[model samples]
Target: MAGRWKNDLNWSDTTPKAAWLNRRQIMAGIGAAAFGGIAGPALAGLGAVKSDFSTVEEPNPLDHITSYCNYYEFGTGKEDPARNAHMLNTDGWQVEIDGLVDKPGTWTMDDILAGTTLEERIYRFRCVEAWSMVIPWVGFELSDLLARVGVQSGAKYVAFETALRPDEMPGVRSPVIDWPYVEGLRLDEAMNPLTILATGLYDEPIPNQNGAPIRLVVPWKYGFKSIKSIVRISLTDKEPPTSWNKTNGREYGFYSNVNPTVDHPRWSQASERVIGGGILAKRKPTLLFNGYGEQVADLYDGMDLAKFY
Candidate 1:
């Protein structure tokens, strides 16, 4: 798998480790003062092998990557997650695995991470809102985890659900789309080698705002399809209902691939604004599958993306 794709990005493309550690230090200090000397656990550095799936482009700055986010569980604003995500307690996180599987039960984080090797994949992330960024994500393939639990023959699709604690997630208090946001993928898509359950960003434990502990990272799909703070994963025989698609099926499709030709109902998807690019930086033309067409286009062979999307 290492040589299946070209290796274009390297350590230089990532934010310096020193800078990331310095930022964490400042954040820890602030947390201590804000929570009566009780700071969050110190994040352990993750060691992962570089992957060929990474793009050649330089990644977005740590500031932009951490500050600008879309975890609606915290709030709808881009900065709200960073400001309010501390309340989310990932201390004893558990993901309930059920539906068509040989072994179905609530599994701890340790269970999810066992018997898997991590890799650093610097992938291009495209949001349905017509914005994009290059991020260095550390995780193993989603297939590994699925294999560990044993996917049953009857399972045709995989569904995911985010944690929904109103006490911790303030945004859930309001009627925003639906509580316990859900998303899904066909069995083949879920098993794709490119799909991963990210545990860290820039080699550090993923920040709360960016789906700490674990989150799905499917580079070819819109950011929303890559659900965050996942609490449940079900292998089902039927296609599962996705939160955004349920809210407005016309705009947010289940297959939400980054197709430049398919314009959003509210805006154009032909071009995207780079997150860390200067204000004057020109919006670049969007690419099909966020420029991962070579790797994922075959999955949609013989199907009309515009119709399916």
Candidate 2:
């Protein structure tokens, strides 16, 4: 089944597999030594075995995915994150898991990844701005981490917070959105298998501009819903504040699912531009659940996605 998707991919629409494979070994943390001297350079040949969890298309190149990003902590421009995110210090990074959990405290990145097994997922990343990219992310399911903390019975939602350091983060100084950007998801949504704690891309350690250390990846939702550079996670009974929604609720709703039928107040969501699809690339039809409804539709079975979105 997975092979069918890989074979059906429109090569012209994605990064070439052979070229991307050759550069895979360059990923920082998952080098040959890290994966027991895997012979190939590309992650696709190493431990990154193709899985049914991935999308049918090929992923965008690491260069495009890393160079173009929205890490407001660095700056507002599309090229800002790549240039300014370097100021961030990720060494010995730690995450504080608190609120309605059985075990709540600070856990170092090493500790969190110690026993976790990594897997590759080629997911479609759709930004709220109507641009998209296919990414090969490396990490474990978000549910696995949540299980480690032992969610309590009363917990209904999961809140996340990005690190705040005025000295390192220049964008925080501006009142653009808010400091220490926050995002949240329903407990069930967090537990969904499609949700993951992404640690790397292209099977290598994630770049600082691209949410180094750790970040959330909710494939079914818009890209912004997948917050980056996370430092805090909490289990709560109420919905936590999200940066965009807090800035303007009318434009960015709590559940920012990708719905072509429901257009954003500023523009239509009926179609989106593919980021790595080249200068002449045309907009493609946006899919329900980003073409992942079969895997995640049941989560919102009774609710009107248009209203919730």
Candidate 3:
């Protein structure tokens, strides 16, 4: 009901909630129609095709979303990053870091990769306002990287932002979300084991749309909290505002967790359509941390999930 999803070039005026909901329902019905028919296998086969994000045998659900993202900065559409990211210049990509740090310098992406080991840690990625995915992230633990940085005592917030290259990325030209997409996490949260500084995925170079240069992966928080295409990483004393929160305060939050009880302003945060999993497929019930809550529930400690979420 709030925050328009419309645009002049692609998206039309926001559809009436009833019609859109009905369309979605009818689509689900169509999928159900094939359930009893010989086409059932055909429909089921599509899930394996769309969800082919991980080469691992078990195929953790979290790895599927992180590996295949709708990050349009590198390009539009869900599959764009997986296909077009190889064209991005990641070899010489440099992350310009500033703020509360003793050693503030532009570090090349290669150097950062060399310092960190690429561990395939599967994490649950739950988006705000319901929707979830599993991604087998190929990267090192955030704790290991933060330990190397040696943060000062005053640091409390860790802010991340995407690089702005209008000539290369046409998405930056419009105010779809924000020019240099920003995201932040508390000092302790940024350094947690579940928090990852990913460099690659599916045994390939980091896709440009999915934060090719580098991206943060916070397991317990919403997808946006884990900013992508990060060109800057800073430690700050004050609470840093994120891109969506800055633009729409009521809709977005700095600590947006995947809480089914606490609904977002525009819609309920209970369920999520797992995109790229297939168009005819049904959106599964979103889990806390895309379903790995057991591994990260304690991070929220003495706080209220409803308020923070």
Candidate 4:
């Protein structure tokens, strides 16, 4: 009769309700616009609706939707991507390659999909936005993908880029943030097993706004550091610039570990909202590196998490 694990999103009738209604309408319209031209009446008839709530999950969809995104470019609105993502064209997406790599080339969506079988991994996605989810994502190691491209010895860092279309993503046009978001990780970090370039979610193709085609998922880092709708991957010797750090240097660190003790400049990191909580779930304490320390804590051994955090 209620959410499996009640999230704590209490939409005060005035603020969240109005926000939700407006976003849904805009997102639906954008979806229609993107497909209506191609699929016409058929596409409109086949439009997507909100998913029936997941009963088998511990944290469930409420957590899944809110804690896993850098959708702010869609607007500071948490629901912006879902609303404005209809503007992204994931079907014909292409990932470009350049920089210090020996095998610099381009990859199409088909090329990437055919490269490996999707592996389902259940990971806790901690959003810097102060919400969280335990997602059963479908993807494989970024290391494997990079190996295929033959990373060179000079590759000290790897940079990623997302596609930008101001026409469809009205948020990009507003100057609320920069366009074509960028992110980077050290070469070793890039090779970590915990780093995933996700293609699907809940066993289905990722929704367009969820960085469809493919996106990075680094479990230990904050959500923004792991970018979406990637269109490029580069091997470089110099430290690459990242979106959040450049925009708000003091607040968004280059290495944004999931730490409950260290607070962000704007708020406390000790707790987070259980998104999609349908108005009853409690907010839970956040965890370090989103609880993958068993596998990744070693990556930062001897180094101070607080310093980078």
RMSD, one per candidate, in order: 4.0, 5.4, 14.1, 9.5
lDDT by candidate, in order shown: 0.88, 0.85, 0.65, 0.71
Tens digits of lDDT, candidate 3, 1-309: 011223233224322223422354446657777665543322331111011122232333323444566666655566666665555565577887678777777888666766454655555567674656556566666667566667778999988888777667655656677677788988878876667787764434455666776888886777878888788888899999788888888888778877777788899877887655677878677666555566667778898877776
lDDT of 4 by residue, 16-65 (tens): 22232245545665677776655343223211112222112443452245
lDDT of 2 by residue, 229-253 (tens): 8999999999999999999999999
TM-score of each: 0.90, 0.87, 0.72, 0.78
lDDT of 1 by residue, 195-288 (tens): 9999988877889999988999999999999999999999999999999999999999899999999889899999999887788999999999
Q: Which candidate comes out best when scored by TM-score?
A: 1
Order of quality (TM-score): 1, 2, 4, 3
What is the model-wide C-alpha lDDT for candidate 4?
Answer: 0.71
**Best of the two (2, 4) by TM-score:** 2
Q: Which stretches of candidate 3 lie over 4 Å from their true place?
A: 1-68, 74-87, 275-282
